[model samples]
Target: MSVDHATMSGLLAGLRVVDLSRNLPGPFCTRMLADLGASIIKVEPPEGDPSRPLGPLFDALNHGKESRRIDFRQPTDLDQLREWLVDADIMVDSFRPGILQSMGLDFDRLKAINPKLVMVSITGYGQHGAWSQRAGHDLNFMAMSGALDQMRAPTGELAMSNVQWGDMAGGSSMACIAILAGIFDAQRRGTGRHIDISMAHGAHAHLVLPKATATLFAPVLGHPPGAGEDMLNGNLPCYNLYATADGRHLAVGAFEFKFWKAACAVFERPDWVERHWQRGQAPGSPENNALRDDVAALIATQPLAYWAERFEPADACVTPVLTMHEAQAHPLFADAARTQPWAAI
Candidate 1:
């Protein structure tokens, strides 16, 4: 039997999710589920979600979902919530480790009521970790995961991005994966599961490639790369950002030999064609640093418009850095504007 409800027809059409989470992570997860046609019941306290004051953000995250106001202090309200859970396929929450247990909404108790409920708890740390009960946010999670340390400029200055990597990628996206996997398993075995998602742990998992590179090449390199010293980060001349004459930036991603060759042709520096990683050139070496300086100096001779026009038809893997407004109006994002309703927000 299809778990889909008759009114909808997406992948999660008939799934019912009870979202007792407020801020970003839990709400964003449920929002993605709702987009796939799941019915989301956003359970909020009488005071409402803390994000409610953030008008556009709140609308973007909670749109198309039913809102239910419940004060756990009231026995009737709590009982009503339990009644809702009886028919819920999934329950998502983002409280500290033992907050749900104190409110009598623990997984053990809820699982008895709804034997097929897939319960998911999201936190900055795992449920049983020493820092599980600690109060922290996305930045703290990124810092703890070592991912933030990698976000550095060529000058070794740490750069803070507006993108909440920990909240969205680690917490929201991981919770969605856990929910779907749990649902599949429960349908097969007729038993529910509790998923513990740590945002910091998920963020750390994204460092797999960098971690492997650091470990595998430590013997040859004498030491692991730090901050912007890694190949993909900013150490390589073939793949780095450069400033143009107008102070605008251009992203040069000519990592492969062919792309580097093409970029060198565009730069009118055919001599730089052989000074690439494929030709036994070590990144961050004295020769490579000199090559980077030469490349930067050449790029600085032209404005962003001139280089953008030059690279528009070349297979050099180079592009002008664009502002958010420019990106939104770009042709590449045309389909996004039509399909993603929240793209405007």
Candidate 2:
């Protein structure tokens, strides 16, 4: 892909960022900063960032920035890095705790060199914790945080996700938000602060919403429904995926009464409307499974395109389950695709 650096513009136009991170999370965070017009100087090790060999993804994340390959382990290289940090506004790294400190790039050391530098350290656990020293990745973090348990399939196997929740949402997104906040705080206080980000902690934080609901319903429900046994996880007829006659799937998000009623009307199954969440009709219950089977059978009578057209004017929350290619080609994403951060790259 061709990069048009001039097209990058944002509020952080004059901000200077020194990226000492590699792989997905740190690079993703720095990319966001670069997109917002920060002057990102991506300092690569002598061997270069690992993502450099990842082809299109490398261009997608590291484009629109200045890259310098330096081996900080060498004395002269370390001196050069110190030069880069002397006036840098922000510094981000993804090494485990104490690693950077050993390299003399710790917060206090960097702060002494540049008082206004916002230093962000992204890790798997945190700076000081029992699990901080352990090695982990996105799957490990998600699994340890119980998020993976909630994503189990009908056969009790964990479903692989298309996106890395721990890396992207937990590490990258959290780091981006903290870096921005750190920048504000540094300017206001005339000093910078160290931002410690734990990918596992961030992943666990996302469980707040559904966890609260599960806690609230636990006493009455015996236990919150287990994975695919829950309403929102495909056990309920109103909120699930259905296979069409053409072997394509459709997503049904009619959890609310109005939408569920509309869907029932469309299926000529008005009797199933009021049966929603009735006694003995809890998700995965015999009654619920029977209703799900009935609904699935009805859905299988028509092809995906037929259902798509039939529900076009209906208020039912029904839509086709599109493939990634189809989604990118769809009109709904035309504007987003055109304005995406990687568009110019």
Candidate 3:
């Protein structure tokens, strides 16, 4: 029951949190708060958090918290649950809409007990909508929101599934932000508020950039992948991925005209400066393909180390395409070794 005095020194230092949901978003949001020194008591429905055993990434995320995965099926524990919530400052949940209400921890009841409580509910959709009651995960949410359709490869292979594109992208991130805002409002207004978070809404929010690409810029650019077909998505001479001689890869992310000019100067490929890789054109057309091929050949002439030496000094965003393991060993990431918990975590 004692708090870690030194550990609880961050901004959210004395806050007590009750995390009642499982899986990604709920845990991720609370984990972030916990990192800031909040006292988080994860209250699972007796079976433990589903994400606790989710592997390498889970180990990397779930740290600095007290977990009591006690099954609430037993009648005796509900009394203890009430005791835990009576003074808890925040409650974070991710059950689909009404599932928590059915279990009897709905905001109304908790607010009655602790009027200043901040109840955060992160669902696939929102509290009320046609799809509000629908069952979904990150992929389904993103798929319906049109966020996924807009993230396809130029060649249009299988749809990519970057897990938590919704759950973490803005769902948990937004939930955490709302909870913090609610906490501040409760302090100033002397009243609590229920935060009904919608993962679908958050996931859709992540698509703002891509969605505008289609709706806003499609007219000028002639649609297709819209802005996706623009220089950034593996379609331009100045910005794309290339293979090196040792079968390694490097990433070039220059977007601004000046940066593009710098990349050209770096490679002594000034011919690429005025090449005009306007969007909406054929991806591998004769001219574009030749530029990509030439860049590929130019990079392939040297090993990744040579390219790293070449690019690191230029401060261009150009970088070696490091494998996951290689990335951890990278000098930039390796400097973390001296930074205590960040490196350890």
Which candidate has the top score in TM-score? Answer: 1
Q: What is the C-alpha lDDT of each candidate?
A: 0.90, 0.85, 0.75
Q: Candidate 2 lDDT, tens digit per residue, 68-178?
A: 989878878888998999989988998989988888888888888899988889999999978999999999989887787888876678898978999888899999999
- Pairs of residues clashing in candidate 3: 46-70, 46-71
- lDDT of candidate 1 over 124-216, digit per residue (tens): 999996898898899999999999988888677888989999998999999999999999999999999899999999999999878987986
TM-scores, each model vs. reference: 0.92, 0.89, 0.85
Clashing pairs in 1: 4-14, 5-14
**Residue 328 shift from truth in candidate 1, angstroms:** 1.0
Error (Å) of candidate 1 at residue 220 is 4.4
Q: What are the per-residue Cα lDDT tens digits for candidate 3 across 234-331? A: 66766787888899888887765667677888899877876644433344457876877788889889999898888887866798888778967877
Better of 1 and 2 by lDDT: 1
Worst 10 residues of 2 by lDDT: 335-344
Error of 1 at 10 (Å): 1.5
Model 2 regions more than 4 Å off:
1-9, 278-286, 336-338, 341-345
Worst 10 residues of 1 by lDDT: 336-345
TM-score, candidate 1, is: 0.92
